[model samples]
Target: MGWRTVLVNTHSKLSYKNNHLVFQTGIQTEMIHLSEIDSIILETTNISITSMLIKRLVDEKINLVFCDDKALPLANLMPFYGRYNNSLELKKQIDWAQEKKEEVWLEVLRQKLINQSRLLFKREKDDQGKRIEEFSCQIERNDPTNREAHAARLYFNTLFGLSFSRQEETDINAGLNYGYSLLLSIFAREIVLNGCRTELGLMHHSQLNNFNLASDLMEPFRVLVDEIVLENQEEKFKQIKKAILALVQNTYPYKGHLNST
Candidate 1:
């Protein structure tokens, strides 16, 4: 069987039991097979971990990703499996996803813009204490057909503060976002060959798709490297190392369980 992630918080004990996963918030947890774990992310609120668990997780060739107080990944540990044919496929997947992905991203940005606009409007004008409804008509029924002009309008009217360039924010947003997509290509390829089905997106998935679910899961905090690297575009680095243990130590729980962005 392949590995799965085990995120620990709240001072727990963990181990393996014949390929079944087991861990506890208390002491002397049931045995857990190391082989069953694909990875482990240790995030503790008030618990000290045993060294044994760390040793086992490392020895089993399982990945380990770490997070911070914001539930964003601070670091990841992947066992070195030799480079395969995946890189070429990764480039192709990237090219395919770029066009459609941006169309989708722009739609997403538009929604965020509407929300932001409403927030600004509500604060500026008393547009609250009343039911606000959204309709398709809210989107331009006959939006600009002129690509540059349409894009410019969307930038100024829709997204003003997201990018520094006022004149080319739409394209700039597109460029930054498109760059992230290419970045995700690296993640998607790994998750796929790592025996993951990427299509089961955490937030946006229609049926009949097969990869990038891991990409979907990884999106919110994709900017970890971006903010560090001065935006997400940079010549590849050996690792975006953010050290998992100390980072995740500060995070709180999500709905009683610790999760990463």
Candidate 2:
């Protein structure tokens, strides 16, 4: 797999040249070997990509994220199918029983709460961490009691003080939303590659959103960005953005294998 997350922030015309992705801006042009790029982030509205290059990127299973005029990610390019029997896999995904889906979602919530508890422990809030751990252990199938919400209320208040609100428009909230959006895109790509629809979720069932599954899968990983924000709470938006992007390279041990999450 490729390792580079290519960011195209400047106005450029992208095309396919030989085996490289050619970028032209004004009088200058540059070539990036396509094999070395894991993903491409079109961070500017002024960028244009050739159809040929787009096809090649899809063939290579390279993730492509597109940002809006305000430089916030809004969409991503996912292929119609995965590398294997995508139709069969999707059928199986659609046929998943509600009982099994609920069971899986119960585990997802359990892990998310566990991670939140660990984050609290790391921040020296042992009492709060124990409470969260208790909540994690008490989670029923599909979180029927909504302990996740109760835990989130305590988690945010204990960590960010009583005044902190994720709903308010603040630099901390902006940084966190941006980082979680990027993480959601990553999870969306993985779901598509596994022949599952991002619109279908294990627990999340927002009718208006297309990335419900991504949101569900990204719950446990959210603590990573939370840690980043805690470490650089006073930093401005730009630095936080760069720090979040840099986190793509960090690997985690999962199921006897290393994962770039």
Candidate 3:
């Protein structure tokens, strides 16, 4: 996997030449070797890209994300076949039993709640954090009792104030959404790279959603984005976005060892 997350915020023409991504804007020209890129975010609609570059990016399994007019992530390009044994992987995914799926989903939710509780504790909200941890312990097979929702309400209210709502049109909400979108893109890329279908999910099964599996897997990581957004609530959305994107370079604890995303 590559380490750099490239963002094209200005109007530029992108092309592929000699294993490098060439960027041209006015009289200035820049080139980056594709081998060094993990993902590229096209943050402006004014940018133009050639088909060759798109094909190269797909071939390299590089996540190419496009942003809307508001400069928020809207969609990303994913390869159709991500592994040499893709057929076998798809078969295995299809054969997953509902019981097993539920068990996996239970674990996912448990980890998410644990991470959320840890964040709350880090922020000095010990009482609310313990409550969230209690909710994590109470979750059962596929969260049939809806402890996740209950925990989320308490978590958000505790973190941001009682008056704050995720539905509200505020800069904080915007930052959170943007950060989540970035996480979704990263998760989707990894899922595809492992030769799995993003449309198939263990927990999230919305018929209209294309990244259901990614959504399911990204649950545990949402708290990371939430923490960044909370710490930078007073800053502009752009700065918060940069901080979230920088997470690609940060190392975190995983399986009793530190690993980079």
Q: Pick the candidate with the highest lDDT.
A: 3
lDDT of 3 by residue, 142-242 (tens): 67799999999999999888998999988889989998998899899999888899999998999999999999999999998898888888888888888
lDDT tens readout by residue for model 2, 1-261: 688888899989999988899999998999989899888889889998999999999988888999988777899898888648788878887898999989888888899999999999988999999999999999898567989999999998887788999999877787888888888988998998988888888878899999998998898999888888777778887777777786676887788999775
Backbone N/Cα/C clashes per model: 14, 0, 0
Backbone clashes counted, model 2: 0
lDDT tens per residue, model 1, 1-261: 233445665566554444445676545565456765555655443435555555555456555555455333344544333145656654554455545655554454344334433433443422321112132124331234333233333333332343455345343444344334433533654565654445644334667544346555444333332333232223222122222222222333556996432
Worst lDDT window (10 residues) for model 2? 240-249
Cα error of candidate 2 at position 258, Å: 3.2
lDDT score at residue 56, model 3, on the 0-100 scale: 96
Each model's lDDT? 0.43, 0.87, 0.92
After superposition, the stretches of candidate 3 with alpha carbons farther than 4 Å from their true spots are none
Please give the ranking of all candidate structures by lDDT, highest first, separated by commas.
Answer: 3, 2, 1
The TM-score that candidate 2 achieves is 0.94
TM of each candidate vs. truth: 0.32, 0.94, 0.97
Q: Using TM-score as the measure, what is the rank order of every candidate, best first?
A: 3, 2, 1
Choose the strongest candidate by TM-score: 3
Error of 1 at 27 (Å): 5.2
